[model samples]
Target: MTTYFHTAAALCLAAGMASAQSADVPDNLDKLSNFQSTGVTEFTFIEQDGRYAEGIKRTLERITLPDGFKIELYAVVPDARHMAVGPQGIVTFVGTRKDKVWAVTDRNKDRVADEVKDFAPSLTFSIPNGPCFSPDGFLYIAEQNRVLLFPAAEFFYESPDVAAFNLVAKGDLVPPEEESFNHTARVCKIGPDGKIYISLGQPFNVAPADKLDLYNEWGIGGMIRMNTDGTGREVYTYGIRNSVGHDFHPVTGELWFTDNQVDGMGDDIPPGELNRQTEMGQNFGHPWFGGGTVRTNEYKGEEVPVEVVHPVVDMVAHAADLGMSFYTGNMFPEKYKNAIFSAQHGSWNRTTPVGARVMVTYVDAEGNATSEPFAEGWIDENDEYLGRPVDVAQLRDGSILVSDDLAGALYRISYGE
Candidate 1:
């Protein structure tokens, strides 16, 4: 055990501060010969102006993964966000800043995206939170307060540019009162039961009113479930301040989501949340209770009840957990099975820098999420972030693709036996 710890510590030390070390560190393992690194390694972590850059600003020349995997620059795009893979090796993703939805297809089977095209442009929204493929072979796009559905034909290998589908759902979600809510356009795919799960952002950082809504409905903040055709809408979970990305656990069929912590609650008090949707309408404390019961700065007088649901995992404060996905691919090893990968969009308010890379929630046999560093070095000690991983997607060959909205590029991580 001591030897294992020592080796792990040595590896961490060798990785070094993001800036002091060379980008192309030699791989010590030879047992896995199929792994290779991509992109440039010698670049400085800090920008030329000495200011931390947000999002993926610099092009990723290479990535370091396990010994058997190869990392490469998959595509050149702008602001790639959430992505959903299709049965025919189709990669569809939304561009948060570019305000478009793009598709990449591996038609030639060369393991690279040969054809890239924009499937949809920003029609009536600024930020597109998610682009998911439904079980019925339709593309579901979430624009703030609305859900747009598109047929699969518009994006098939040789299909037409525009899909035949129409806008199926819109922002008919009427939160009790209409007092200017700060909403995010986030909607997950319909579950096996055929209910569309959508997450709503809290009206403000904390519950703004002295009196909570729904009889001070315990655990009820901003999550709702509705029928696919936009009927039978009901609140699924409460106390969710913000949910940027979410998905069902592949094996357990459990729901998991990333919730950003309320700001101005101190530098480290309110860490972000990786929560399990264990029960319908379950509450993971937000304004009234959060950061493990650390009260929000805005509403300090509020009290948290004993029954408030605690977070399954607490990530670093201000890390900004955005998109998340489960790893079911056989590309890496058993250690990555069902692991949750989340993009930390980094922080701007905290004096000490936080977030900017990807984090893996290690899953136990019981499918609980435990926080761990799956990917790092995005932030250098000099306080610079080269790439901000926004979302993760699984390729046809079991490899993983990460989109960097700032750098406007896609990176691939492929592994072998």
Candidate 2:
């Protein structure tokens, strides 16, 4: 054990890592991979039970799910935008729009996370809002301008440092000129083809004439997939405004995603979208058609340049459809089998707030899709948001976890035992 500790200590922090990095925003990934120490030991921890956490639990009581289903506070994860449950079912990593990726563990498997702490305290993360695990247990974090891969993350997360490296280096995921915090919160998933797919929301309300060629070539307004080692990078899905959530069909293996619509077109003009991609390089109509064939004001009355595939579900406008996952677990009733569970992040500037709930969709044999609210009541009678759900992920046991950035917590939904 001593020899192993010495070898691990020599692996990530050779010298004092802080002295070698910038004082303002410290990042020692290269040094860590080179077998050196960062000299940073302080870690931020979120209390599991306290007054702040009690408030989040109180809000969960208001969440109304279908009968026989229960929702409870899973963990207190601040700014938790997305989640990736480990293959071993040991720990769940939660990402944020800010700088931290939380490692939440339920040591005894009680279904309530007993520990919530920052993962890799030595690294500086900017908008690390997407986390996904490979079947072999490699964790990939999609950041604003980088993609990081943590090998055996579930096993190594107990320490402040672990085996860390970049799958896509900083400024290489997208061009520097295209970097904008506005719509750059990336989400990633390991696809059925064994490739890592990531969503790149273009940093504009509408794609301009000058940026069309560049955006099309670089997949700035779409999803891109690449090998696990970052090779074979290519655009898979094309021409959508901003998609924050995507998943693969279990039986068919096709890609499906949700896209947020163009704003300022009134609260009810162009609808938000839940799209299905049967083929690669299929354009979903960005500047040409806002959402569900509603033409964007910037490109009104012009023949759309590319052939557009309309969305499978035309959601309510400005509902801000974000993350989604297919219901593959058997804990819920048979009706939820193969259903799509997604989150609507609530309307920002509408006259009266809407959404802030979880939605369920069922696709029939003939390819028709129908959607309805599965869990709701986060929006109060006073037009205020009690919680805004961001993403949905399933645990090893069949229960699903919903992340809320507004309330900064994770909630677990389970069916009858």
- Superposed model 2: Cα runs more than 4 Å off: 1-25
TM-score of each: 0.77, 0.94
lDDT of 1 at 272: 86
- Let me know the TM-score candidate 1 reaches against the reference structure: 0.77
Please list the Cα RMSD from the true structure of every candidate, rounded to 1 decimal place: 14.4, 6.0
* Model 2 root mean square deviation, Cα atoms: 6.0
lDDT of 1 by residue, 1-417 (tens): 011111324324423532243233332112111222222222111111111121222424333454576556566554567777775555545445323465665566666565455553213333556777666666666655456655653354242223333243333443335324364546466665767776766556666666467513421356667676666767777777877778788877778888887888778878888888777767777767656567776656746653567778888998888888888887778988888888888887888788887787888867566777666666776887777778887776788878776655567777673
Look at candidate 1 and tell me the lDDT of residue 109: 68
Tens digit of per-residue lDDT, candidate 2, span 1-417: 011111224313422352354357568898778758888676666667767778888888888999999999998877789999999999999998877798999998889998888899889887899999999999999999999999889998888878799999999999998899789889999989999999999988887878988988888899999999999999998998899999998888889999998888887978999999999999999988878988888999899888899999999888899999999998999988889999999999888888899999998755568999999999988889999999999998999999998888899999995
Residue 386's lDDT within candidate 2 is 97
Return the lDDT, model 1, position 368.
65
User: Lowest-lDDT window of 10 residues in candidate 1?
Assistant: 43-52
Model 2 lDDT, full chain set: 0.88
**Best by the lDDT measure:** 2
